[model samples]
Target: MTAADDSTFLNISLPTGTPKAERVAFLRLCTALATASLDPADAIDRNLWFAEAGLGDLYNKPTLAAAANTLIDLVEQGWTLSTAYKHGPLLAPPPSNADPVVEKARVRRQEHLRRDPQLRKASVRRFVEGMEKPREFKGKLVTVFNLMRDGRELADSLTTAPDPGSVIRPYIQIVDGSRCERTGYLLHDIWRYFRHTWSNAYSTVPGRSMPILIRDAATPHHAVIGLAAISSPVVQIAERDEWIGWGTDTFLEEVRKAPSDEIAAWLAGRIDAQLGEIYLEDLLADNVLQPTDLHHPTNEAIAMLRADAERHRQKHHRTPLSEVRQIEQDPWVQRATSHLFRSKRAAMLADTLEASRTLRPFFSPKPAADGLCQALSDTKAKVQLRRLIRRARGERVGTVIADLTVCGAVAPYNALAAGKLVGALAVSPKVIAAYRAKYSRPSDIASSMAGRPIERESRLSFISTTSLYGSGSSQYNRLRWPAAVMGGPNDKWISFTELGRSRSFGTSHFTDETVDALVRLSRVKGAVVRVNSVFGEGVSPRLRKVRLGLAALGWPSSELLKHGRERIVYGIKLVENLRDYSLGIDPAPEYLLDPEQADETSVGVWWFERWGQRRAVQPAVLESMRRHRLVRPISHGARVPLPTDETDTTPTESMFFSADSS
Candidate 1:
């Protein structure tokens, strides 16, 4: 093939939103056309091509027409054998009189292609092979793989030995959901394993979810350690709200009162119209003059009426109604009435009267008849009103805290104290900075402060239960940062009681039973298993199959896989920030580089000297630490030992480890 044909075939770019069947058909057709010796001038016969590819029965006329048009467009763009072979590939055709900039770009691309012939050739070969043998679709059904039985040899090889001399360093990196590269595959596999072996509950990766992979960077082959998924900050948390001075009662009260307050303000204005009508009615009722007489009253009669009204007003405490009556009796007033007050008074009188009647029940400060205050107070009316309020406010109702949703290490790494490494990275300034930037919009910041949907700023990070509590493993507490450094009162290194009080208020697809099953599975297996979704319920079978395939070898199957759902609501506060908190940090000072460098020994010594001398640590800090059994009293300048005995022997491990450990 000509260089142009090679380039065109090698870099096939398909339009998005095309159906799978049509895409496959198009690929097959392209491969057939490229391999066959056809004349460039001959128009492609759609019917013959479809028949040759065994797709004649599958596509309809409209679909075939669309496909034909797409093919024609591609050929026009030099993405076909005719254009590639007849003329050079459009990407780098023989120089025509073109713009200097465009020509320079083309020449540069050609140079790169020439310099990397092997890479280009490999790419072309892969594309041709892929087009020639497209993947066949089987009807969606998940067949459990017996990894233990079928892949015993492979399984044994993977688990047979641990490299004692080879240190396992896990690096955590965030995956961009928009790109479907190797990182995407890593995320998919992690979720799959969690579903089949850890949690039978199906989990979904949310649009705002930051999916992270933990990989062993020490080995030549970067094997995955585990998966950590962090979703958008929660809108409401009871404990978090309490901490921020907005508890459940306060949040609900504010929501309920806002609408009522609005209605009250409207009613207050409305009451004034009723009062005006009442004043007008009293004047009209007490008038002594007949309507005809008032319309054509002489000046003498007007003077007499005025005199009488003055006398009545002097005798009574209130103003006499005859004062207004006398004005209506004047000839000039009658004439002006015809010009200005003829229909205006009548309309005003009617409106005020109607308002007075409608507001009669509320005059005594009772519940408003049809206003928001009335609806909020009445239990029956509150449901709809509450929904309206929530919708109007966009469901933000509490304080926001950056939640550390999932944190742990896989088998080998977990055994090697990799949990602390992953945990520290989870709260690293870089990761936190990315999250903050993601939600930096004005709307997001507003929502987060209000405890609503958008979460832009977070001063705290928390976890629900320690790995020790759920998985019978001490990796979380031992390896992770002590609660003191995270900005909590020393007395409460970790709040065990708060775990039960944390609440998740949102809709989730998984039924309570499914969630319970997943939790139970995690407890039984001694692993932290989280459910994103279920199986056949609302989830697509194709997606379920792909996720299931990512399970670890020797995964056991269960029958409770009927429901397919993504997104679960679990509430707990496992991590927190007590002091000045920020997300990304410039590379930490060279000495404090690695995540492990922030270990208890280095941190404790630093705190004792740096913060202690300045009295930055609270008076109760040391006491609280001692109370929590987090530290042992020692003389100044004494060395702090590692948390575990296994770690104590590895003095070199502590010194050399850095964030650049990867």
Candidate 2:
């Protein structure tokens, strides 16, 4: 329909009036009588055909006029076309009221059946399988695997000797049977057993057997697996050493005390134990005995002694090397020796650091008589000095600088450019002495620091820090809303730093860059309004409102949103920031990084299309939009851009360089 005079008319609500009984009857009669005398079988088509055939000749036909009069009478008597000209008292009295009650019960029963556990399980499976891309199922599979790993550990503990009728078989079956969609065959059996064990298994039962056990536990089946998979978390907290150690400490002690002949036998029996349990056994044995065989002991006592003796004999029989030059001749042996030395050093370092906290306060020495007088003025400085000294020795200088800047211990400029600040800090006498001693020598400070010659610059495409949004992340953007697009400048066109400290740009210079990116992204142009939080300490609630509002606007499916690779990456970053901020560890916000814009996807574009259609751009506006390829008419209305095929192989750069897209 043509729009009314006002632009507001384009937004009219759909009419909802229902026709009266008399009017409905009259229309039905006219339609039926016109169709070959209302033959019910050929009603619609024949009526139109007959109407065309007889309308011209109706003036000359008296009989036709009488038939028409009869039709008019039927209509006047309130006979619909389906009533066949009879207005008789209905043969069947107003449908038995019981029928409706019966129908309602039937409908309820059908609904119950549809949601029946076995049926719903099947449905859930089908639903998951039908998903073109299945991330939830993938996550669930990981959960299942983790559960299986834990179950395997527990299963090993359950059995001492192999049995044909082992519960391990059923246990493994149960684990494997747990599906991403529903509890599988064996798991369902286990679930049934669990339900029988617990009276409150299903919500339907109180003092009786739960009638809807399957239905009640049906939805939470995968959830149960999920809980089990991560169940190790609390267990780890409860028994950290036992949880992390491959074998039990007692089991390892037993292995260590065992005769060399028995070590292999013990290991053979204990390989199936938890990793922590086995690891302890090996470690204890290494501590007490010589480093005989680095690999595992043999499976049999007799075999183990022979292997041990042979290794020992061979070691004693080999020629010894005294010089470093001799050691370099055997590269494999040198590498192994180096690895051993490095590992031992690392362990020593870890132990030293753990103990250093206690030792860091003071060395066991009295200072000179003048020190006592000077120390009184420097107690607080001494404590700060001790911390700085320990940090200089134990932590990376760059990390210390960054933390100091973030915590406002030092200015950002002073931290990044560290010459004068380093001289002023007065951290460790040892660290300072080493630096001063080196720089005081007749050697270049830069050469000493690098200790190597520089190579030619690499020719590879070097992605700069500015070009990327996140560390070790992808470089794609997914904002597709017109408002989101227009809110920021396009990639090459806009520099967000020019906007100054816009709330949208956030506090950091990096945030301004992020704002620029969002502005440049093609989607930020059509936001109806920006809502700020009226309450709360942060903008989180307002951000949530935007999310839910867009969702109501028919946000695309999870799959569609997932398909926007760049958008998903940004969304992940946004969520990560939310988490980091909660933990007081916010990364400097980068350019074009509006949390809402960052989280927007191609799916969100679909939502804008849905909301935009209701408040349509007029013909003149639509035509203008067409020039920019923003909108296009389909059968009834304009259609949105659908996702493109991944394998199209059309060069992305080519498409990007093309004219303004709709």
lDDT of each: 0.35, 0.23
Residue 319 in candidate 1, Cα distance off native in Å: 61
Task: Name the weakest run of 10 consecutive residues (lDDT summed) in model 1.
Answer: 141-150
> Each prediction's TM-score against the native?
0.30, 0.15
For every model shown, the clashing-pair count is 27, 41
Model 1 C-alpha lDDT per residue in residues 1-662, reported as the tens digit of each score? 23433542323323344466765665666566556655433434445776776555532433333334334323322233432433211222232323545433332332222222222244433432232221222432111110001112212222343632233344555655442132223344433342222221234543245556655444433445555655644544545444432343443465455544434444444435223321222235446333442224444444444544444433322323343334333443342232122223333333333333443344346433346455456564454333323322222221124455566544333333444555555654445445545545533222212222333333224323322121123434333333455343454433223322321211122223222333333333333222323210122323332223212111221211211111122233333332111111111211112222222233333222322223222333223222211011211110111122332222232221111111
In candidate 2, what residue range of length 10 has the lowest lDDT sum?
Answer: 226-235
List candidate 2 segments past 4 Å from native: 1-643, 646-662
